[model samples]
Target chain A: MIHPLAVSHDFGVWVGALLTLMVFSFLYRDNPFYKFAEHVFVGVSAAYWMVIGFWTTLWPRVIVPLIPEASRIVSSDTPLPERDLSAVVPAVLGLMMLSRLVPRLSGLARWPTAFVLGTTAGYAVVRYVRSDFMHQIQATIGDGVLIPAAGGGWNVAESLAALVTLSGTIFGLIYFMNTRRGGTVTTPAARIGLLVLMVTFGASFGSAVMARISLLVGRLQELLGDWLGLL
Target chain B: MKRPTPQILLTGVALILVVAAFMAPPGDGSSGGFAGAVTYADRHFSSWFGILAVFAFLLGGASLLRTHGRRVRERKADWHYSAVTLVSFLAVLIVGFLKLGGPPGLTGDPTDASSWLTTIFDSVLSPLHATLYSLLAFYVASASYRAFRARSLETSVLLGAALIVLLGRIPVGVTLFRFDSLSLWLLKVPNTAGQRALMIGVALGVVALAVRMVLGLERGRGGDGS
Candidate 1:
């Protein structure tokens, strides 16, 4: 009595439930179903990204403007006049990206790839040097120096904590410096630096965990509101 | 050492194009000038590339099938898992591509919740992804308890700062101690300072790595270095 499509929908819902449960089963133990879901997840996500990149990045940025009607008019305020052949360079570069699929032509893709890498690297370097290095140094020096409170007598705890943090930051940086020599794992200074690094990593892990839990809570709220209508 | 013929040629061509695009004298015409011509070429190229990438999804799908199919055919012990994977994959693919249970006519109405693809993806895949990600909470708590220890003076200071910040972030901390001032101090001063220092180090490392990559000094290309 039921329509064929209705049966298909029901079947799909059941399959989806099974997959969801299978993945969740991982909390209890590793199993075949979890692996299957994981692989499928990877495959689907990769395909989704490639599709999105083409539609969002390539199509809009490169393709649409090529149409005569879509071309922008150049005026006194405009930076550059329109050009037909300008698209050719990017087009060739995009085609070069596909060259990786073919063993022989894969090398051809490197030119476009290198340009992208080089530009990104250059931008990152300048941004990092200004924002990360200079800014951090200025901040570390300017603040966190303990001064006497209105009541008088040194704010011992605050002053000591600040000193320790400043020291830890310096030691951590030194630990990472590849050029430095004589600071081996066994040395007292090296051991202290390593300990600081470990604590920093631990704190990062804790924060990351909190972030994930927050995301989970958000998703749960959506499910409750939409599916259960419990809002 | 084969002379880098392809690399040199590609780089040269890219440089010439970039320079020409930038330096060519401007013209008065709206769409007939050198700029317009270049723009046209770029757009058409982009559309073709987009189309190529879209079709390439089939290549990916085929590769997935082949890999999984081989395992199933070989009758691997866990081949049943492979079977489930292929079935689920094909089911999603068919539902999406065929637009199964889509609107009666061919208007391409994605809003139709009745569509099997929408129903399956919305009800199933979305929640599954979220659930998997949520499992990290337990692991994180266990890791933190074990790792956050105060064995020395420096460590005690680190732990103390972390505890203050942690309590500050939660509503319970604010309600219990009314120590908003202490919490804010921990975050604004120590947390920010530490984060900034780490960022600087990371930035320096990134710049050095990037320079190496550009000059071909860092050949990240596959396989163990010979």
Candidate 2:
């Protein structure tokens, strides 16, 4: 059967199909076409991200706030007429980061780097404490182990599940204990922890595989449905 | 001493920012007082960071150009591929900047969907990224096959869990033995419990590291203990 792509002259689809094939060629062997495609991919991706960074982030956030009039020029959704002096501080700090590209002035970059590090560290502490620590502990503690049955008594399966989960969590924590000497409590808990960790890793691996397969399916759909029109 | 001064100042700024975050008024957008000033400062600093992060992309681009340029200049093996890399980089950059095939105006957005930039991105970069990511499917299949060998008790448990998860997620397993329910139980209960433990530990570690950085006990940027 003649493919629809043979008749229709969609240049964009053709280009996409060819590039997708070029990338897939790596599965057979590392050829020049694959290398060419790989490098182009890297270059274009870097450029694309930079374009997004400038247009979406840097231009509006740093420039427009300081210059305010740039809002009109850049087609900013919200036009602030008054200049914000506060915006100038980050611009200066950002310029300080760029100074590292210069020879003698490289020391200036540390200020921005330090600022970034500090802010990130500060930000992470708040987020991690609230979400990862407090929320997780709260969930663990508040996990309804004993579900009320239809008649009146607690559900045995749910209670067992709760016990297992509590045991798994405790054992997982015990596994990370560095100073624990081999003992009745520590050894058994450590063993259970290892088993729990192994199960977790396996589940993670399975999920990762599923995700990759979905991507593969997507590419196949593009090739067959879009390019070949076989689907 | 010179290096330490900047480091110290940056640390101080971080601490102040953190403290300000806590002290800032809950939802006062009017810019009334100290809360307003703190909010203003916070935003400016954040924007500066965003701008600098964008500039880092330039450094990355420069590095790419330098690598390929050197290869082209030296006439190294497969130097033609280097040429391809450099040419594509320049082509995309110039095309995007000029807004070639964009709307007929100087004010046209360079990255407008209708522009050549988006066309190249859609046809080339998107496919390339998708294909590259999809290649992991082949690698993962092969790797999982190799890794799932039940060499010992620990390995057996791992293999069992992996197989259960893999099969249970698919339609056939769901229809055959209600493995989906079993998988869900494993994932929601034991898996979540294990993950929570790990996350709590990681959070504590992060808090410690952040405190160290704020105290200026940890080295800032170069990590040379400055």
Candidate 3:
């Protein structure tokens, strides 16, 4: 027996494949096909967000609490105490987000924005001290460097690589430091730091490229196996 | 001389709501008021949004037609490109929406293998996207060559360390130099340490940014422009 969801899923899979291809058509040249796909994606995403925002965020959180529920206790006229006012606080703030839609009331949105920013900054500061500064310092020191080789198998290259990594990390950190003694742009230590940054960026970019290609390969495999049935 | 009542009211509402949200009981798992509401929201929002977005597709198609149709009619330079784009766009839209080439026996089975839309997307679009993404490889190599230069003592040290890491990652680098063990150590110990540090810093930055946004002090929503 055919599952009901299967029909929809299959339709979705084909539609998705076509959309992906349309987006890719940009490589050959920008064309209307790509634009249509892109616009459809955008429109769909926006509409979806609105529905989600109303059903998920607005109705249950705001509406349900406002409705009085039957109390379990006998001789009690009161409904289950309304959900704590605090629970609705974020929703209120979120609602403030809508103020941006109204030109005259848009400035009201700033309060929520500020609240979000302040909390984020506070969190980052707390997190950074432990992770970026202290941990990095402690990590630079390794067991191989400190302990003596008891088994007569002291790995030289391993120790050296560790040392280089440690040095490179330090230099890279220094390169990013904003403080400078003078107007000079090039400093001995700073140059080494920049080099380390460059290598890291290169490796990161290469890895990202490889990851995308791998994903593409996986998609292709699916197309061949399932859609074309060529496997 | 004029007061902004709407602004003040909105701000007041936001402040009250934020405080209320934090104070609400960490509701019982899947049962309590606050927690249940959050869970419900998370589960249902995305699908709801997806449904709404489907309708938005019509708006997008209309916009595309308006913009591109005018360009083609004006005989603009590169008009042929726009013509191709429009044709492909309409073709896919019609096939996919109308379920053309769908299974012969089925009523609404657009996913059938014979579907022209599926064939076009699978054969043409997927590879193009992949190919575009793959271009990053060349850009990365070019950027590295241009950016990675040793000009100072610290830079030289950094370069030396990076070379060790580079050599350690690849099979050729490890086999040629016989530095497999060394590379392993470099990645596990030093790389982890560096990554942790960066993550911590990033976390801190994120927190600060979030706080600023919440407080209404920071402007621009972390974007480049006003």
Candidate 4:
């Protein structure tokens, strides 16, 4: 007497299949089911992050340190120091951050925002300079282009690769430079930079495609193998 | 000679603390007292900021609820969707809050293996998230087809490179076209070079931004899109 519209009885499979189909339905056109699924996903994810943040971070680091009793309740096994006055600084800053909810007091929120920005900026300067800039430059310049190995044989391929890298990097940077009038030399450098950039972009796009396809394949396998049991 | 406003004072204090925390030397297990305090403060600053972020998240949630609640109340167009959104938000929130089907403790993790929260996460959220992300596959394929037309020399080079790379990643291309070597050479030389250039540029840009913030020249609460 069950209608053909009924889904399978397996709880996990049934729920998963419904959600998967609902999401995939967007391929055809937007509709109510997709909207509902999308909203639920967003809502649940937000809540998940909140709950996770509270349990992992705010509770232990901020709250428990302020109200010593919370430390025992959150984690009974580990012994922690009673009160940390240092936590009060961030706590106050956090409260200041909440002032953004009020229109007039929103200006107060800028303090915490600036704190975060300053921290990120200060840290990023050192990190990016050391890792991205200095390290890359060192790697590029340190390659043995002219100097042969201890064996005294010249590596033709290694030399060619090093030369290409040095030139490509130089030209790429030149291409990014603006506000200067291009000369005959700079024009050729910029064009070579463009060619290098195109190749990079192409490789990036191809890698991205492969990654997306893998994700699609995962969902398809879930639908076929997990829910449908058809493998 | 002018008195600094509360905002400026607060910003200054924040900057000093953050910079101090960043500059604090790592503890080598030999030091204590002020060194220990500095080490502790340095470690906890990020988590303190995380707590602050939680408050921001709370405001975001409150805003979401307010908007959806208003829509549902006023019966605006597509208000049914708003109702769905609110119900969904509340359902997940309440279930997690109550720790339904979870171990009996006030602060017991709601995401325990047997809990409704975990069930919803595993069965509903994971699949929905995966499927939604998978839609990018179709979009990328379509976009690549439309955008990678070989109308010019640069475009042709790009298209050809992309095809070679794509084929190289798969098994059949190695069997037929011997694309692996070409792809490797292209990636190792030009791609790495281009990436290195971009990284250096980005690092410099980040340094500039950081300097501006530290100097109080970036006056938009860091939210002002530059």
Candidate 5:
């Protein structure tokens, strides 16, 4: 920590400190300062992303491929499009996406939209089935009811703990799938499942708190150490 | 689904993809065969999808400009804020696109360390974004306060687990409560079980949704009512 009198005179650091304070002002309530900061953030972040997207995706995937001559401006090192004609497909679809800007031709955008959603649905169906459904179920209950002991014999206590876990997993599954139906599956197991879910959510909240607190601490450290020179 | 052409396209594309993904011999399809062709198609589709996704940023920028421009023109509420937004947006775009204060060319990296865009991002955008996320810390605390006020068995369980986990993480709390072991057990056993169950359930939902989309019975997000 340095003295407040010794705070750095850098213009960027000052700007950062002021923006930090402006955002923190939201904690007091809505105000013009907060609003201004929020708007600036929105605009700047959006433009930052657009500039990034143009440089990364558009310039390489579409521009360089479609117009090989344009590569001179993109940088000397950018590989001349490996797959030449294939770039035309996405380029056309992307242009079709912008057709929505015109009121009459807005329906033309649906073709690209359909492609995006269709491809996503295709991947999602296969991915979730293999990863989330089959793999998760296997991980949850793959352990046999009779547990192996560290020594030589079957361990009763460990087996019972395994049983508890297996039962909790089943109960939780039942709760999620059969809650709205309100049938025989909504037995005492569902209540247990509810408790398990609650515990899970609480643990998740605690984890999220840790993450946010770390960020908060980092910002505070920056303000104190870098800006105010009073760490 | 209600629209015939898009619905068919959606169904057909999804069906072909699902079939190719499942049936095409796995392992990145590197060797020369039908499998390689299928894998190549799938990979190209994904790359195209990424390119298509970037176009959404264009739509976002256009939407922002239109909304803010309309508000400023009509002098609506908070019009000055809209004006500020437009100025900042255009300023960043212009400076970055022009490659200001760096290599002067269309291909020059606008976000290079030496560029003015990098300067604005470092001092302005970065702080605002991080501080925005930091606000969530305060929000989480306030939310937990309200939630804990609910006197019930469930809240009791939630509070108990949260307290243990929170205490287990910090140095002083761990020394005082010895909650580290219990927290580990809670996370490893019960949390894992619950998460697995949730995952399975959500997977089932996703599959169902996918099936609906593939069958043209549903067009939820990109449907746009048509």
Candidate 6:
């Protein structure tokens, strides 16, 4: 007996490492392996999401509501929840969203589309105004450019930083507001604003790059340390 | 003008929500009549959105099958890829739904201890996603190298800021230069300032768009143009 293909051999570790290699093969140039992996990724990921949605959402909200008996699947000993007829509204709307497949009733799809859009827009406006506009401004400069010291005196360094923050914010707004394209409508505020915005975007992108670097490091660690048994 | 059902619904739904926003100032659970009703409606609408998302996923699955199935049947270029996609999709979907290898039960757990779907996810999906995302490191580095040429004052500031931020994240920068605090200051002060400005602008734009949608001025969004 070969001891079931050796005690140390693990199936999943090998498959994961190979899949990682297949995807990385694109760095060498596009090829069949990369394409195959890409397709598999797409298919598997979509199916995985669907599975999650079924388990997390549809199974509970739709199935359990429609067939209260389905709740027993969650646990054999738990009480069955009350049957709710309201679940049918969402069910119908959901089907309506997919009516685009048919030629004649394709227009029926608009109902759900409109419903989602309306609700989202309404929801978003309130959130954006409250959080983004009102709260952000209040935190940024609503108390004036005075960073009060713990003992009630002005902390010069903190106050300077606060002033810079206020000025940068106002100038950045100036740049965005002054969207005219020409030879030179560039006000001093806009010029300063442009610099601030660039710095901001650069810092943001740098954070993203660092994130990717961490992921790369992690993937490499997995390949070398876990799969190859080398740290 | 011809088809009006979706338009009417869009107007009505948006009006209700916007009206609720004005009339039912949040934390008004104590205020008994209309405000309470509006709050309840708002909660229901959010729930409805979530419920629709689940169905939308199923719809997306159907769309994927139709698109790929056609390509495979028509013997389109690289139809084998489509075949692979279809096989993988069906295998995962079926195995997950059937709860294959799970404890003799109807619980729809895709990651059941002995499940094939879980095996596929652990061995296949996780690595693929991590590897794909990690590939961005090369792309981002190369793109930054090209873009950070410092042709003007703005680009120079961008280049400097990026380098400072990047160096701040590395052990050498922290050890030799004490660049970490400088980078943190840059992120905290100026970054916050710019982001807040942008957020305010975006909030205003959203309010405008929302109002347009409510008034049915944004009819093009409804694909039927109703």
Q: Best-fitting candidate, measured by TM-score? A: 6
The true-versus-predicted C-alpha distance at residue A110 of model 5, in Å, is 1.2
Q: Judged by lDDT relative to the true structure, which candidate is superior, 1 or 3?
A: 1
Clashing residue pairs in candidate 5 (N, C-alpha, C atoms within 3 angstroms): none
Q: In Å, what is the interface RMSD of model 2?
A: 2.0
Ranking by TM-score: 6, 5, 2, 4, 1, 3
Count backbone overlaps in model 5. Answer: 0
lDDT of 4 at B161: 76
Clash totals, every prediction: 16, 0, 45, 0, 0, 0
Q: Where is the poorest 10-residue window by lDDT in model 3 chain A? A: A67-76
Q: Pick the candidate with the highest DockQ.
A: 6
> Where does candidate 4 clash, by residue pair?
none
> Across residues A33-70, which tens digit of lDDT does each residue of candidate 3 receive?
77666555433333333333433444445444543342
Chain A of model 5, TM-score against the native? 0.88
Q: Could you give candidate 6's per-residue lDDT for residues B1-226 as a string of tens digits?
A: 6777777777767777777877866763456687776776675787888888887888889999999999999999999999999999998898778777656645546667677778888888989999999999998888888988888888889888888898898999989988999999899889888888888888989889888877777766652324
Candidate order by DockQ, decreasing, is 6, 5, 2, 4, 1, 3
DockQ value of candidate 5: 0.68
- Per-residue lDDT of model 1, residues B10-122, tens digit only: 33333333333444345432476666554443334334445445535544665667777899999987877767667767766655544567675323333367776567656
- Candidate 2 to truth, TM: 0.89
**Candidate 2: lDDT of B14?**
68
lDDT (C-alpha, whole model) for all candidates: 0.57, 0.77, 0.51, 0.75, 0.83, 0.83
What tens digits encode model 1's per-residue C-alpha lDDT throughout A120-167?
444455567677887778766666668566699878866776776677
Q: Model 5: per-residue lDDT, tens digit, A148-212? A: 89988899876776776777788888787667654334667677888888788888988889888
Candidate 2, B89: how far from true, in Å?
1.6
RMSD of each: 8.8, 3.3, 10.7, 4.4, 3.0, 3.7
- The interface root-mean-square deviations, each candidate in sequence, come to 6.7, 2.0, 9.2, 2.9, 1.7, 1.7
Query: Tens digit of lDDT per residue, candidate 2, span B72-190?
Result: 99999989888888888888887765567877643677778898888988899888888999899898888877877888777888778777887889998889878998898888878
Model 5 chain A: which ten-residue window has the lowest total lDDT? A177-186
